[model samples]
Target: MDFFELVNRRESVRGYLDKPVEREKIEKIIEAGRVAPSACNAQPWKFVVVNDKAIVSQVARKLYDPLISGINKFALTSPVFIVVVAESRNLASKMGKLVKKKDYTNIDIGGACENICLAATELGLGTCIMGWFKEKGIKNILSIPSNKEVTLVISLGYYEDKEPRKKVRKDIKEIMSYNNY
Candidate 1:
């Protein structure tokens, strides 16, 4: 499918089948994430692919209520879980001067996560982005260093149920403005 079609078809899947995602497809998704643009080319991101059932369950246990209810459910069904982490860089401490003030790592990692989601949709797989877990618990379970922050957790597998209805959004004319607001 083309880009527009993929974008429209790509829904946040919350239910998944028992089938496992192939290693080749996972590699492609990771590759897509790696190629995403980053601020200043820092690319300060790491992706942890969790396929083991025990670890997946442990990570799922960290999820809280309401906000992550669907994700918590998806975690139990999807065969693969991908955790996106952003490494913190102390530019001032390293270079003796401050440079960019924004959290570039978070921005870069978010782009990478988007790439993976789009690629998964293109490859006919289902994915759900999750971010309502307890960070300390996830860090302990994954053995991630203190310097790295968990940005998102994605559940991946073949879809089992129909996609949810798309949430309504304002039209371009309604939201967009002319040269001046």
Candidate 2:
């Protein structure tokens, strides 16, 4: 499929099938993220892949919340997860962050994460980028460092629903301008 088609097809897959993603496909997805552009060449990110059934189940527990009526329950059906972690950035990126008063690390990480998702879609796999997971619980379960921060938990597998929902987006006129806003 073409890039536009792939992007259109890449939606947040909530319901996953009872199948596992291939190891090679997972590696390729990570490779796509690894090559993504970063601010001042500082990757400032690490992906902790949880593919082992037992470990994936443990991580899923942290995603479920009884407080929320219907939130993150689909994590239980996910066969894999790629936990995005924030790491130490380079000196130039740090300086830029201080000067610009904006955290470029997260922005760079978002690009990488998107690349991962696109790669997964190309591989005929499904992915959902989740930010509502329990960070501390995930950290403890994965033995992550005390200083490291978990940014996102992306669930991955074959989707139970094969169709991509129609995208609802702003019109071109509302979001675009000729030369000025």
Candidate 3:
């Protein structure tokens, strides 16, 4: 698909079909993230692909809080979950962060997450990037070390048939500027 079309098609899908996503396609999606650029080429990111049904359910449980009860309920139905973990910055990136006073690792991980979502769209799969979950629960369930940060959880699967919604965004003129702001 054309890049623009793929970008337009990429939406936060909330509904999925009862079908399994192929492992090969999952690998391709992860490969897209693996190749994403990072600060000082640190590439400080780890992807934990969860496909086992039991574990998927356990992870899904962590998405809900008592008050809301079932936020991100779509997670329960998605066939796969890719947990994006942010690792510590490398020496160069750390020094750069100190000098620049910026967290480049997060910027890099955001790009990697976008790559995964775009790759999934290109491969005809639906994905939703979720951040409002119980981070501690997810880390414990995944056996992730305390040193790593749980940045995002992506639910992936084939989408249910539905009419596409019009894309809504700020006008280019409103969001962009020339040499002068």
| Candidates in order: C-alpha RMSD to true structure | 3.1, 1.1, 1.3
Best candidate according to TM-score: 2
| Tens digits of per-residue lDDT for model 1, 117-177 | 9999989898989877788889999999876778898888888555546867789898999
TM-score-sorted candidate list, best first: 2, 3, 1
Q: How close is candidate 1 to the true structure, as a TM-score?
A: 0.85
lDDT of candidate 3 over 17-75, digit per residue (tens): 88989999999999999999998999999999999989988998887565686689878
Residue pairs with backbone atoms closer than 3 Å in model 1 (clashes): none
Q: Largest lDDT belongs to which candidate?
A: 2
Model 1 segments beyond 4 Å from truth? 64-71, 89-100, 161-164
Candidate 3: TM-score?
0.95
Candidate 3 global lDDT: 0.90
lDDT by residue (1-181, candidate 2, tens digit) is 8999999999999879999888999999999999999989999999999999999999999997868986899999999999999999999988988999888888999999999999999988899999998999999999999789999999999885567899999998999999888
